[model samples]
Target: MQIATLAIIGASPPVRLARMPHIELPRALEDYFAFAETEPTRNGRRFSITLPYMDGERLDRLQWWYHVSPAQEQMYEGTGLVFHRTRAIERFCRHIERWLEITAQRFHGEEPIPRLGQQASSVATPASVELTPVDKVVNA
Candidate 1:
């Protein structure tokens, strides 16, 4: 059994977009799921869909680190752990699929924009002019 970390974001409850690593799938598995939607994120984007899976736990601690931590550095600061279990890969896939579908439908068109690192150098405008560049000239 392999462990996978799925990220979800949206306004509504219990819906999420999942980002998964590339892997091979059996032909029989393709029919079991459907692509529901896609949404952008701070880094890039995510895709959503529906599939089959069993046993899902909405983790509070994990959610806090993944979703809430980056919002305000002073408030919540910590590293997150991966929650995993030995279950059928199919089941894991399915659970993520359902989450993606729900999250997509809720925040369909709107996606969060990532914050840029820092503000650029302040540009002085005519109204806020301090000193003219001509005044700095030295007589030669």
Candidate 2:
């Protein structure tokens, strides 16, 4: 088994638009990501999600480190998914796909954006389109 973590860093506008007002990046992420709880820290919230193997064994984890200072300030966040089982890599990749989709809808008005670590290349595909391979997504 191999262990690794993949993350994407995204930024949202601080000021509210005429239609969309007060979209707090961290709060929006916590709401859409659907994590159990956030640990209160001096700076912000520490959110985590854990997935175990089918045999009820602890194996992988996805962690998000988010910090928001003041309601109207820009949000800087990192979302990382770590896994130890190479066989279950596809599952983790799908999870990242959904996370990015929801986040883009919430903040970017459903506009398709590029992958986190890549240039201005489009990452969005239609519903009928097949997803990119797990290796590509992980490397992206």
- TM-score per candidate: 0.19, 0.22
Q: Stretches of candidate 1 above 4 Å error? A: 1-27, 52-140
lDDT tens readout by residue for model 1, 28-122: 22233444323545543233333432212221110100121223323212211111111222354555445545443111111121111222225
TM-score of 2: 0.22
Predicted model with the maximum lDDT: 2
Count of steric clashes across candidates, in order: 3, 0
* Candidate 2 structure quality by residue, lDDT tens digits, 1-140: 22223332331322221222212132322223323436555664443444321112323335433333333133223212112121123344445546545555223222122113212335676579665756543443
RMSD, every candidate, angstroms:
20.4, 19.5
RMSD of 1: 20.4
